[model samples]
Target: MTDGEGWFVVNACESRWRDDGTLGSYCTFEGKRRFPHFGININVLGPGEALGMYHRENAQEAFLVLAGECTLIVEGKRRPLATWDFFYCAPGTEHVIVATSEQNAIVLAVGARGRGVGGGVVYRVSKEAARHGASVERETTSSAEAYAEAHADLPRSRWVPYREGWLPSDR
Candidate 1:
């Protein structure tokens, strides 16, 4: 629902679960609009699933481990993060999050959108990110190349029709 020209709200559970291949399932309470200037989403990651390619961007990004455990791989370092843990990625700082617990992990991600040209983002080939299939084999700015194995490209990944029980209960 919307109120005024610039405000809206939707329950996280009511939003559709967008599956971005190896990135697993997620949702950004937006429907069919030009990608929001400020992006936000809740990622539902199964064990071994990752948030996305290990890459840095010209824009800053932040994440919160809302539930479950995940390994945060940043610039080749692996750090464990659990519920309530928050992480910040400064401009040009490479990072990726991978669920490491036996169950699942829920991460709330927010980032400032960058313009579409001149290195808004760059994918990196990191052994640490590869642990969960979140790294590219070659350093490039192409999302398609970085996620070729999983058939994902940000331009084409977003909201979809909702599915029942998209979020599994904690085990």
Candidate 2:
């Protein structure tokens, strides 16, 4: 579909979205102009190239694999994703995505852009935990814990315990 107004076809060879070795294109309708609800991007992850696990403060993301194979590491569980596979990373969920095969895999990623307010918020743990490389851990009750403590009255508390279903490795 080609329209002279309010529509644009972004060439895949040139895209503004950061690429972690992923070949793809995006059609930004209202882009940043839409603020919280932006357009969408199609990503083609090359072999051995996987997106690192990270979380946004407020964006809720979802991905659909159009071709090839890949792995989705949401929260902490790794799930194989082939063509026609869809994955969702709701707001506050710490997650990562990786390409599993030698061939490139195409994936469509969409999400809302906004400030995050929830549990999965990353926080600095104890010196021991930090020293031992405990990395991101469940909040127990510490001065630092107060920093990344999931926001008060989060609507998804009941699901926090089962966050492992998404992440590659649940802490």
| Candidate of highest TM-score | 1
Off by over 4 Å in 1: 1-4, 116-119, 152-159, 163-171
| Top lDDT model | 1
Candidate 1, residue 21: Cα displacement in angstroms equals 3.1
Writing each residue's lDDT as its tens digit, candidate 1 over 39-101 gives 888888888989888998999889999888999999899999999999988998989999999
TM-score (all chains, Cα) for each model? 0.85, 0.53
Each model's lDDT comes to: 0.80, 0.49
Count of clashes in candidate 1: 0
Report, for all candidates in order, the number of backbone clashes: 0, 11
**At residue 82, what lDDT does model 1 achieve?**
99
| Tens-place lDDT digits, model 2, residues 60-145 | 77888877788665555557888889887777665556677767666777876544344234533333323222324544323244
Candidate 2's clash total is: 11
